[model samples]
Target: MMTIKNSPASQPMLSMTGFAATESRFTGGLLLIELRAVNHRYLELNVKIDDNLRQFEAQVRELLQSRLGRGKVECRINLKSDAAVANLTLNPEMVGQIAQTLAALQQHFPQAQPVNLVEVLKLPGVCQTESIDTEAMAQSLLNGLSQAIDELIAARQREGEKLKQVLLDRLQGVREQISIVKPLLPALISQYQDKLTTKLREAMQAEDDRVRQEIVLYAQRIDVDEELARLNAHIVEMDRILTAGGTMGKKLDFLMQEMNREANTLGSKSVAIETTQVSMQLKVLIEQMREQIQNIE
Candidate 1:
């Protein structure tokens, strides 16, 4: 009944996998459907049922296959019985022909043969008609399954929502780190220029203004401002998709890769210790999001 995201803080979350069990004792027997789902590259469903309900396999499969879009889902449907719904009728003509044949056999082998009444009954024509409300039973089972599937899909969506929220939070974390590293850029360049200028002046006895200007410009190019800008843009795009709320798994995953690319570039080009730390954090957060997005539909 509780079709909420199985996000237990003590546990590692319900995963992209979950189960919803529903039982509805309908018609003359009981109808039960168990729906289990796991993360899969595509939507796949396996259904299991007793031989009595085998005739309705297609109906059950279609119900689930249409409702669920992704994941390897397994559904087990049970149609059990407690009492017989109808009586069986015998084929009178077939039974009479079989009886005549047996009588002729008895005439040929009088002392050696005797037919058991149960054996005669088992000649296949003795028992004839089976009557049951199959339509009512099928409808009952389907109704129960429909309810269970509704709960199952709602569970998947609720979990997807939580995943979206977590990814967005990590994204915002990356943005905050980017913010922290932004104001440090100019100061970082100034620090590098001052150090390299002093080193150049002492190490090579180079006091030419042009040489110093070249060193300053070279150090500025190593700054990660451009990488930060691109990363921020990627973050904005990812946030847009998360808000739009559809099947954006692959898109989000690609964005994660792009974010990590920018973070890596940022780390490699980064000069300030603060920038490097922030860049590393961005990479970590993106990796986390990537792992989670694999489970999304």
Candidate 2:
């Protein structure tokens, strides 16, 4: 039996998509277990098993829930008699004896039915099938199921590593966009002040205290420094969460929402073409991360 265990600190981001299969043979039967998983907001398990294996469904469900955090998981278990295990062999001697007896009976009663091969096979000892060991079959089923789960988790982890790298790349893209927006802020303020001064001088023909106050207020309104700062903070937290990965799907998603909110605010306060483009690019990157996060567990 294979035991699947991982320390929380060592656990990586796990994708909810995976597949695995395992089988074990007993006295006269073969037990097969298969697992499939796909993304879901919560753990959703559906188990299907042979009628004889119904008794073990609860145990299988418990085992899956204990190891998996989130996914729509489907488990299928089947038990079937293996011909090799049954060891079906013809008893040549028995067949010869039965044939002789049937021939003799037919001669004595001419009207008697001709030798019926089916009836001969039905006679005692003419055909035999190995008896199944119920207990052994049960144990093999549980052990095979354990091994299958281990394989499924391994597949999920491999996929998760890929998702993690994608998310990290998108986060870097978001940082790049933010950096672009920061340098443009000072230039944007200067440009806005110049434009406002031109309009005021054209109407009043003089610069005054009123003009300075209006410029300050307009700069404050368009300042996205605070939103950018918060976005950077969210990115830092997201990096930390990814580094310490363990069921961080929901947390990463929430952080994405926060980042998007900041991006929206930045766009709303945009006073220049460069700032508007930065805001849109930031939102695109954050949306990409959020889409990938949905598949993480």
Candidate 3:
């Protein structure tokens, strides 16, 4: 039967970067497994192993692909033999063949130096090292890898929780800035209307229909009601996405872009210094959230 490790049930948000390592010792050698991951748009597995364990590379790749959905992941394996336990075994068939060939050569040319046992043993394929059970070793290495992956996931989850809190705090900051600007809009518009009315009375010395039309047109041009409405809607959508959490990085990123656009429009249309400051604050908060979102998975 094959054993497999399962991830935690309540999957919190995950960050794309983490590190973990595990080591195991057996009678023949020691095995060390290390896993490192960083943010990436898609899953990319890079496995490195000693030449002796090259045969296990495919299994390692399959295991990583199954466990991870997104990231640039690198898996490194190191195996070391215990000097006290290491031993060499001769291949009888190979040694016999080499001996026969050497004998034939000696008969043909008696002056040829007779090959000693040590030199024959040193020849290629003549001596075989004490062998490890490949299947058993592979299984042990896989088990160690599974443990390392589990640790990596836990680390990412912890970091992700921190990210979530930071995002929520920034979201609240955005809401507060919106609140500060909302009440100022109506008063700002009223002040502008009063000023225009007084200017027309002083300059024209009579109530003119054209002046009224000009005031209305100027008010419309500076109105930011549409931008404010869109900003509120984007904020609501972002809250929903964050609450419903699962691979929300891209969605949150798009929502940030929308929010920034609205803020820019609001700033451009602002007739009051208070409104301009609020717009700047909103943009700064959105930018901070965006920077954190890039690390989220």
RMSD to truth, every model:
7.6, 7.5, 6.4
Tens digit of lDDT per residue, candidate 3, span 3-96? Answer: 9988545448888889999997777788988999998888888898977789889888988888877889989999987667668778899988
Residue lDDT tens for model 1, 1-297: 877796433212223566889987755678778999999778888888877889999998888877676788889988656466435567888888988997888888889657787777777558764555789888888888899988887787778778877887888898789889878877776777777778887888787795668766866777676787798789889877776666677787788888888888888887668877887898899999999998887
Off by over 4 Å in 2: 1-9, 84-131
Q: Which consecutive 10 residues in model 1 have the weakest lDDT in total?
A: 7-16
Q: Count clashing pairs, candidate 3.
A: 0
**Candidates, ranked, lDDT:** 2, 3, 1
In lDDT terms, how accurate is model 2?
A: 0.88
Q: What would the TM-scores of all predictions be?
A: 0.77, 0.82, 0.82
**Better TM-score candidate (1, 3):** 3
Predicted candidate 2, C-alpha RMSD: 7.5
Q: For candidate 2, lDDT tens digit of each residue in 269-293?
A: 9878888888899888988889999
Q: Choose the strongest candidate by lDDT.
A: 2
Q: Please report, in order, the local distance difference test score of every candidate based on alpha carbons.
A: 0.78, 0.88, 0.85
Model 1 residue 117 distance off true place after TM-score fit, in angstroms: 14
